[model samples]
Target: MPDIKDPLFQPYSLGSLQLPNRVVMPPMTRSRASQPGDVPNALMAEYYAQRASAGLIVSEGTWISPLGKGYAWTPGIHTPAQVAGWRQVTEAVHAACGRIYAQLWHVGRLSHTSLLGGQAPVSSSAIQAEGVNVFVAENDGTPGFVQASRPRALDKAEIRAIVDEYRQASRNAVAAGFDGVELHAANGYLANQFIDSNANDRTDEYGGSLENRLRFLDEVARALVEGVGDASRVGIRLAPLTTLNGCADADPETTYLAAAKLLGEIGVGYLHIAEADWDDAPLMPVAFKERLRTAFPGTLIYAGHYTAERAREAVARGWADLIGFGRPFVANPDLPERLRIGAPLNEHDRATLFGGEARGLIDYPALEAAEA
Candidate 1:
């Protein structure tokens, strides 16, 4: 059993919601949505319900529109059928006494033409994401990773349209019964394309100055706040130092501190930071983390390759209000309990991590079942 002083098992108040623990199951793309319409389904609902013990569960990245899609078999929140499909997921989670948020995603230049009906992917600039690949179905409908196609820059009008799409998606998420919505501004997606320096080279209002670079994120976050009818129901994810999918800023500290201040000004509920988790990745300076805690007044969550000791240390030190465990939550449905009791965990099957049946999605036994 965990000590009474263990911060990881303590209850937390996230806005109006009371979370039972500080373990966050972050949004991870499983690519397991039903095909044809990219709809959520019963299998996903079961998967989430099994892991509802987390303090919060941010659903797998669901595209806001067809154009927002970057990979095959991932879910979307655009159409009526998609919304209905997600209603089942939310109902299931709620019945299990879990709080869940939908992650709205748009994968800008990190997409292939095949996934977009031969239309070019859109980004802040017309640059090909060299040495990066997006998952897509080939001409024969066989899914595999392919080189990202060259993208065209979005016009100001088109940028506004995408912002509107994000707004509507947030509304759809709420209608589908989610507790709130999270904007996937991290992981080299559409919003990150605008924020990162090397990926954006336009000489327009949406580029050049730091304020201009952060404009898209601001608009989108405001739209989400409006869509949810409250600022406390919206969160934004940001990856300042990660260069995933060829998105990297020349000065991440300055860029992200400014971004954090902007989010604070917008009155969003939380700021979730995705730390670079790759081996030998540049460490995010502790000073920057302190600055971020100052910059954003609401809840702060940090997710990466965090061990139980590291997570407790971060939370106990006030660096993170909550710590997200990604792969740990994959194979351990009772992750919070396992961490509390120091129980052994089931190893995740890497082969079935994406676009498969229930083998890896829901087969992991809970602690009781494992013991039995």
Candidate 2:
């Protein structure tokens, strides 16, 4: 057994999986998938395999369909080539004795016509996310982000079809050999847009009241549950207080608390809360944390700017079962081991954070190599 005194090192049961430690490597979009098809490749597989030391590895946001894609070069699980590519990633991680889950994503209004083949992005409503920009490959062979375009509100039939897309993506993920799946409902993406009243203005059954607003999440969760055939093998991410990608709910506390309750009712294996990682980002309140603990009956994971000390405190206080390290893990593949030995961490290069080659991806030296 791991040292109980070090709450961060102690093992915890996350749904049906028995994690070796409380360290989690949360999803961070590197936007490095192979171009032309946004398919996972050997380079992506190698990157994930190197970081397989985490107790749980949540793969970056992967689009569920072409319509769901918002950024250039981000992987998708909706196609045959993409599924095969992800299979390589999963196999590599598994070979390294790591368990990985694919995060299902749909960006909604956080998209650009340049990236969408000139098609307007789809969302819960026709509202545009003012001042949001999405990264796209420039015609000059350089990467650049352009302003997000106004989105067309998805019709009822289209909404239902998107749920099917999520279901198919879950099936593809399982077939691709992922240990499980995580629905990317956080960070002001598609699901977040539907949940945020400011982003969603509709008089239909899927809009207006809080219950109506939650309808999209409910349907998507249900479809994933049905596809995966086990609630214990599924997770959903939520970010209540974030105003990212032009999404801000009228009453975040109440809206997120209710969302937690609904997700609990749906019986997902775990709930991943994404805290804003920016320095000036507001911290999630203690009261909100307590309420969330009561609202969800499954394992709870917290992400965003968490240090070792804070992660330990959260685990000791029984609030978070696991703590996720994003940028930290980007530069430290063996993060758990480094934390265990209290080694100085390597800094991640911000310039190579987004779309990049191996220079910043799999080239980050491990602690032993750095010492050598």
Cα lDDT tens digits, model 2, 273-323, are 999889899999978998999999998999999989899889899888899
Model 1 scores worst on lDDT over the 10 consecutive residues at 1-10
Candidate 1 structure quality by residue, lDDT tens digits, 154-258: 999999999999999999999999999999999899999999889889899889999999999999999999999989889999998888888999999999999
Candidate 2 ranges beyond 4 A from true positions: none
Return the TM-score for candidate 1, rounded to 2 decimals.
Answer: 0.98
After superposition, the stretches of candidate 1 with alpha carbons farther than 4 Å from their true spots are 1-3
Q: Residue 301 deviation, candidate 1, in Å?
A: 0.1
